[model samples]
Target chain A: MPIQAITPDYHGEVRDRLENFHGNQLVYVGWDRHLLFCSAVAFPLAPDTRFAQLRDEAMAGVFGLHPEWAQVDWGRVSWLLDGEPFEPMLDRPLNEQGIGHKSLLRMQTPDLKGFQSAGV
Target chain B: MAAKKLNIKDKYRLLTRDLDWEFSYQDRKEAFPYEEFEGIKITDWSKWEDPFRLTMDAYWKYQAEKEKKLYAIFDAFAQNNGHLNISDPRYANALKIFLTGVSPLEYQAFQGFAHTGRQFGGVGARIACQMQSIDELRHVQTQIHAMSHYNKFFDGFQDWSHMHDRVWYLSVPKSFFDDARSAGPFEYLVAISFSFEYVLTNLLFVPFMSGAAYNGDMATVTFGFSAQSDEARHMTLGLEVIKFLLEQHEDNVPIVQKWIDKWFWRGTRLLSIVAMMMDYMLPNKVMSWKEAWEVYFEEAGGSLFKDLARYGIRMPKYAETTEKEKEHVSHQAWWIFYNYGQAAGFHTWIPTDKELDWLSEKYPETFDKYYRPRWELARQMEAEGKRFYNPGLPQLCNCCQIPMGFTEMDDPTQIAYRQTVYNGERYHFCSDGCHDIFVDEPEKYVQSWLPVHQIFQGNCGGPGVEDVLRDYYRMNVGADNLDIKGSPDEQRWNAWKGVA
Candidate 1:
């Protein structure tokens, strides 16, 4: 396993550190501590300091943190589902009949390599 | 020697249609098998006319040129420090997975097209199939050869042929295409040519090529764009197949409608992965899945389906399902990428705030409210010096290898998990049909090749994630390939952009 599992507490900490460390830039955060990683790339794996156990917790999902699914506050910005500029369109129907913005903006960023190997 | 340019207009004289010799020896029914299986009747074989009307001579000339261009790229990249030029080996993870999971389908297309060449009763259809067969093979070869440059540096490429057969998530596409290839030639055309080619071509080719354009993957961009030019031809074939079938006899309408319904859902479910890739994976996302689907499926396909009303064909059966999931494919695919990235040869990291803001603007409905909180909480965790990961094994959807986090269409809030108990073992499935398939034949499915399972089986470079990264991905530990690789296009891009 290339990663260690972490509790929600530690997972939360890592997310915070990832943001602050990079400021605004995208950076890596995982359940492993391996600074020995090569530093020559555009994006370097964030140093695994706080969760030293992550490197060993591979299948355990970084200490098995965040068990529940990522919850969505649907009513909050439900109108965004309507295909129009925000301020005026959040109130539009959500895939109400045919064309709506909410149905169009669904997005994902899969780790190129992670996706392939997961089904093993 | 440069082949003479043959005018496409003069196809009949060149094709030797005169050689058909009027089928003197054999009965027509024996020659054509399964024509009546669907109860469709064809009065005239001469009625069908290929839209492109490409002759063999014109076909090979352009094809040979495409190969010549591709091969030159291979030679240049290999001779130079192509591997050295990558922004980082981590970026290769995308390519690695792409080769293993998607490249094989190109070959499948070859087989399907080849079968099409022979099975098609008409000369025009047969010739069209012959052309497509060769093109598909070329796609597979070029993809393999171009990726060979990474072989010395990466490990996953070495195992794709093996992975494609055994992986679980791979089954989604594998089963989809397999289902089509197993069906009649007409069905194959409907499944791939129409459902996939016309309905979702933009989702597949556009993002891949456009993303390459944005990320500075010149070779990939060029190759992708080149291949897509052929896709336009395939799209035309797809459109005509449906239109021709429907127009031939009123009977074909129902069969065509059934196929449209069945295959549309199948294709949409399969594309969920690509949707995720576009919305999240691409550093420079173009349009979100929800947006693209709305335009492509709803606006375009929707309009087409509406137009079909006059012809007696109704809307896609699972149109509701597709419409419902459109808002969530990107959301789900990204989360899956983040959580299950360990076994993956590629790297997974969080999106930036700016990108999140982009998501907010793009998905005005669910951005800051539901999705934002997850990121916000993650941001808070990061602020406290932490990164999150799921605590336990995700409940796998029996149908799709994706986790059971996706819920029923009408209610996106609930996690959807449908189960079917067999003789002794209880099999978990993502939906009813997937359960039905598994129930029908369990052994065929148990032998799936999921990447995560492979990691546990020690099929990868051994237990360490870091080890897998180095061996499987040839990951530079942390890097993305961009201008440094100097894709032929990138070199030109800089020269044109007037940058030194």
Candidate 2:
């Protein structure tokens, strides 16, 4: 996937330097493959939020991304970068992990195959 | 008394063509500067034929007659207390949605068409737009005048002009027309006159008008009929523009094709609201959105595209997905409104027992399997006095500006999510179709006035929902809300029926 390839060495480099970072990031939090309503949810994140907090808020519509009937195991929920999974340091603030603003994330079932090559 | 009469066709030809002269005082390039930048070639402007052969005199006479008839009905409806004759108080919510979401679009079309009427390079095309501009103005006026009877007793109708500009849900229609309005003249014609009017007019007009008729809304039905008569001419203009452009030059084909692709997808996304209004909002429904889609789009539009195929035109890229979406869009859209109706100017409610049964019957495959359970949960919550509402703002799609609530294709359990990065900032779309539009014109869409984002940025009056709704959106609490048992209109309706 494009995201994983762009950040293959993500853990060693950005993850190490993330503790001091403080900036906002916009993200998409989605679950399930069948989009009964729309494709995904979008939220602009605050600098102080931990991944756990962000995850909880997404579930509760804090960032305004409420999908009815969506259920995800909060702990197991992974953030997708370019449709590929990234192991987010859940306890850490997003900026601490160098996940800067405008980051795209999808919290889907871990084993679901990503990105079908559908023609537009 | 015995004077020879001129043939009507010959007279039309003489009046339309013989009147135009080469610009003597003004430079042609300076006068019509906007049309050619999109690279659409039109070597011979005279090749543009208005099949309807409409001229100002005929248009004035026809439209004036229609207006006279429509207003006479409007007057009678009001004088006879026609609001009391509607199917239900809930039925006014459908008109509320229409007035709040759609009538402003007619006004916007008036402006867009007025621009093309002034700016297009061809006299025939310009005249067509000028006529359509007046028609659109008439539509907005008649729709408002017709709804004025309801507005006298209803809540949502009073604030549409202002609400359409600032309300979150209304941003969907506003933004779509704004996107079209921002384009060059040729693109505007293709976006609205061609794609919207010709290809998708039936889906928008038929259900609402038919529902109006079914619901004993004579005023709306009358206005709808009058507007529809004008729509026939608009549709002809749309068809003629496509053919005229295609036949102009070989190089124009690809440009027109791209425009067709962009606009067809845009138009479909905008019409999703209408789908919900048809299927769910109207208490006395005329037809399901899926059935309407099958008849108007898949069947009729399919044949029209086949004819256009000879000219190297094809259907929109996301035609298959759009077809798939018909089964679910109305359901999903209504669910969103049901959950978030409090924040809106119009009221929304869960479908009644008979209405739910109608949905189940209409959507045999997906309704029970996918939507019914969630609605059941909502029903349970309401029974327990919880009455669910999305307590927070919804994440709107970057393209359509609608809440991100659609499910994946053939998979109602999951969200259909797509994203693309441009200039290091990631943009999110609710579908591949919307994503494709963004990629094609990232510069244009990236600047979208996304309502949810604007709210978060403190640009929407203030940081809180109260300020946003009252100060910015101007939504009056009990009146323009979905407390079904508590609405003033509902109480008024009850008193009118002697139930209060």
Candidate 3:
């Protein structure tokens, strides 16, 4: 239902518009079933940043702290962009792959459950 | 002729309802401009019963007497060094959360009630709201006085009002009140007084007050006792407001129900911090968060909805979801805080072995299988000098402003991620309840001043996390935040106790 207001023309100004960020769009990445990290990590990234750079540089600093990080096989990892399954072009920029501002990318690693399969 | 003596009810009527004048020259609608904006039809103002009959003079006398007793105890608690008598220094962290996050809410309640009091056309409601507004003002004052004894010896208490405006985690409580205050008058009553005070208040107060009693904090327990009668009156007023609206016009039922659903969900999300406090922060434990939910919410609220069924009001929409979530929210919330302790205002730590066992026994269904392993790993890492802190910011729910840490009830392994696009911009929620609220009022929620989003946008002090924490948030680095193991709070307590 639309909001009931004194003025019929009530429209909210979007606070997190892409233009508000200085040359960066917000991207949220979560590793499926990994409760150890608590929640998805939100990053402000330039749209031209490559998918591989996000993996090897930014994600490594976060997911690497887990004891099971070393055993994960990257080749078997699957991805979901905004809840739809997608395969990212590793060397291509995120904007070219339809990843826009405030996009959620979830990564799932096969056969490597969280910390003894206890969802840790 | 002998003058006749008047009784309390007659005096209350003469003083309150008799003062309102007829709108002969002015338009009635113009006087109460916001009454019909939200589609509520109030057929008769006379049907609005006054919930309480205390006159303003009597109210001041009673409150002044209570203040005399309350301040004497606060003096005694301070003179005796009550800070040293707590079960553990860790218990003080809960007080920090209360002073910063909860006390300021009382002030906001004062503002809300005062504003809404003038907007209602019914003289009874205006008088009741005026009394409650005064009660709220007293509450915030007494709460501050009660916690000031701890401030002399605590780190996090110093910059609470500052942090509430700027900090990441404190935004959860801040935004909840901001949302309620900015809403229409009737909706504010349904949200704060009915849904929060009437339905969900015990879940908040019982935990804190009982936890204080158990943990040897007399000041807080006394404050709780002093506020008990006011809360009772507020709860009755809440019930009266709902019944008056529902009986006046049938059209009002659906609007009230929608507000109940939205507020109940918002209240449950806001109470996650309290859940963490009950389950983890209190050094001498009260009941577990799950047990408290069962007793206060399920048992008590089950009967409330049953009573309200006569007026076409059912249980809140996501109450079943909240029932399942009670088992996991405390653990999940604590994990989020522990992971981001570096950025928080209060200290966080892994539960001791005994507390862990208590949690396992309280939540036998999920604790051992899911949460225990994570804490065990944290303990192992702490032993190796690798205490874990997430080096990245968390995605916050666009409505609740809490990090999206809640997991699916059925799965508990997968994060419950719900998203919808409004006007080409995507918004995410931690659960269906928050998602529904956002979907209903996208225009209202899209303007949320999310702390993390603001930080990323460089609207906060600086680009770096440390810069924001130190300069913008005003937290004392290495003093107010991080794990409590070797912090100044722990060291000071150990020194005072002569522990080597």
Top lDDT prediction, candidate number: 3
> Comparing candidate 1 with candidate 2, which one achieves the higher lDDT?
2
TM-score of chain A of 1: 0.16
How would you encode candidate 3's per-residue C-alpha lDDT over A1-120 as one tens digit per residue?
556667787988899999999999999999998878999999899999999988888888898898878888888899999999999998999999989999999989867788868878
Those runs of model 2 whose alpha carbons end farther than 4 Å from true positions after fitting are: A1-25, A31-44, A56-82, A108-120, B1-14
Model 3 residue-pair collision total: 0
- TM-score of candidate 1 on Cα atoms, chains taken together: 0.68
Better of 2 and 3 by lDDT: 3
Q: Write the per-residue lDDT of candidate 3 for residues B1-500, one digit (tens) a residue.
A: 75597787787778889979999899988999988888899989989888977888889999999999999999999999999999999999999999989999999999999999999999999999999999999999999999999999978999778888888988999999999998889999999899999999999999999999999999999999999999999999999999999999999999999999999999999999999999999999889999999999999999999999999999999899988999999999999999999998889999999999999999999999999999988888899999999998999999999999999999999999999999999999999999999999899999999998999889997879999989999999889999999999999999999998
Kindly indicate the candidate among 2 and 3 with the higher TM-score: 3
Give a tens-digit lDDT track for model 1, residues A1-120: 111112222111121112332322211122111101100001112233222221223312332343221322223322221123232223333223232110122111122111112210
Off by over 4 Å in 1: A1-120, B1-23, B27-30, B38-40, B74-91, B152-155, B376-395, B398-401, B419-428, B431-500
Tens-place lDDT per residue, model 2, B76-172, is 9999999888899988988988999989999999999998788877777777788889889989999999999998888888889999998888999
Query: Relative to the true structure, how large is the alpha-carbon lDDT of every model?
Result: 0.57, 0.78, 0.93
**How many collisions per candidate?**
75, 20, 0
Better of 1 and 3 by TM-score: 3
User: Tens digit of lDDT per residue, candidate 1, span B202-271?
Assistant: 7777766676666555666667856876888888888877877887888888778877876776677778
Clashing pairs in 3: none
TM-score of each: 0.68, 0.89, 0.99
Which is better, 2 or 3, measured by DockQ? 3
Q: Per-candidate interface C-alpha RMSD?
A: 21.5, 12.6, 1.0
User: Candidate 3 — which residues are off by over 4 angstroms?
Assistant: B1-7
